[model samples]
Target: MRGVVMHAPGDVRTEELEMPVILEPTDAIIRVTATCICGSDLWPYRGAEAIRAGGQRMGHEYIGVVESVGGEVARIRPGDHVVGSFVASDNTCEICAAGYQSRCVHQVMMGSVGTQAQYARIPLADGTLVVTPGELPADLIPSLLAASDVLGTGWFAAVAAEAGPGKTVAVVGDGAVGLLGVLAAKQLGAERVIAMSRHADRQALARRFGATDIVTERGEEGAARIKELTGGLGAHSTIEAVGTQESMEQAIRATRAGGHVGFVGVSHDVALDGAEVFFSSVHLHGGPAPVRRFLPELVDLIFQRRIDPGAVFDLTLSIEDAAEGYRAMDERRATKVLLTTD
Candidate 1:
């Protein structure tokens, strides 16, 4: 099998690797059909996050066919086409039962397992894998793959922000997740969606995703613009899809009093001012999205062709060319990159 390995910052390679097998009763193995690069992966690639001693495996989002399942696995069987959450959870634990599978007691971070490969192991198979209605059409594969991570995360952001009918929603960040957040907000019944982006292409896509307005200004200016658009009261809900000091602050400052702010960006060196948040009078809720909680509904939406979240993948490359995909994203030439295993 071949997989992606990051030898150091700015150095990602595709190389032959060992095949995965079920090592636990809750484990299952799958032949990866599709996988992609994530914005979070850039943290290590750009040296913002430290790499392990030797190197680290990359990728967490995946959709594939089950090759085998452990003895304890039920519900998911071999030959099943499945999509799973980036974080594997038993789904039977207290936290999981409460709809926070991302923090499941027996959670396994799939990034360490590396789904960007020919085959990979999935833990908590019965709880982590969601079988599609039947065999999937090739045309729907990209969207289904998006449901495994980005789309689910974005949807979670929208839900956490309390986007609903008659409410004005603002999204901070124009990346794939942020763009999809716009879509989620609209789907959740937000009356008005504001997308903050400087890129014309992203702005266009944001509009296509139901963004009624675009604000190019960032940071404080961007927050001010959001408030201005909402008649100085700010948005009823704000989605913070970028995890940074500026983005976080902007999101909080852009929401009206008693509003909600859903933040899903992988936080990196973000420090919040106590006084600012104390006076903001907004509800803040978000973390690594509990994607497992929404997989079924999202998959249904994809099957119905109700949402084309896959449009975010403007660039596609063979798995062997993943390095270029990373470069394209880092250079702002692509909104999202899909790495086809086939």
Candidate 2:
């Protein structure tokens, strides 16, 4: 089977490798139908993070058909089309049972497990996979796959930020996760949603997703703009999707006192101003998006046509063109890239 291999910094290749087989009692093998590049995949690709392992696959977001299952797997069967959460979690565990599957004690990181391939070996099948309702319309697959990661991340961010009716919400990024945050905020009943974005194309979609305002400035200026749009009180809830220090600070500073800041961006060595944050009385919370917790609900939304997140995918390429997809994202020529395998 062919898979993506990250050999080193600024180096990724589409190459042939042995297909993964069922290795554990709780495992299931999935024939990946669609997969895509994620922002998190950029960390190591740009040399921002060290790659301790030379040979490893990239990507975690995917939707596929179940090809086989281990003896312990009883919830799903062969030929089932499904969308899976990035975290390989047993949803019945204590943490998962409490709606924190991203922090599941025995969770497996999909980056290392690698979904950017012809097939994927999934652990905790019953807990991680959500079967699609019957046969899905062909065009809906991309949106369902987005729910597995970016959409889920955005939804989690909105939930953390306390979005609801009569509240003003602000989204601090315009990528796939941030764009979906706009959708999530609207669905959660936020009266006014502000999206900080400069790209005309993304801004247009943000508006379509229910963003009430668009702030073109970044950093301090952006914070002031948000407050100005909110009548000087700032937003009641803010979602941070970019993990950079500037992005995080901008998000914190844009929220009103006693507001909640939902930060879903993968954090770096960021040190927040303790005094400023304390004075704002902002409640900050976010992590690897407990995707497993929302998988079923999000899947149901897809089956029922409640949301369409596939718009974020501006470019689609064959699995073999993974390099061009990465290059397109790196060059800012594409918002998000999708990969398909036969």
Superposed model 1: Cα runs more than 4 Å off: none
lDDT of 1 by residue, 242-310 (tens): 999999999999999999999999999999899999999999999999999999999999999999999
lDDT value for candidate 2? 0.91
Give lDDT per model, in order: 0.94, 0.91
- Report the number of the highest-TM-score candidate: 1
The pairs that clash in candidate 1 are none
All candidates: TM-score? 0.99, 0.98
lDDT of 2 by residue, 238-306 (tens): 999999999999999999989999999999878888998889889999999998777778888877888
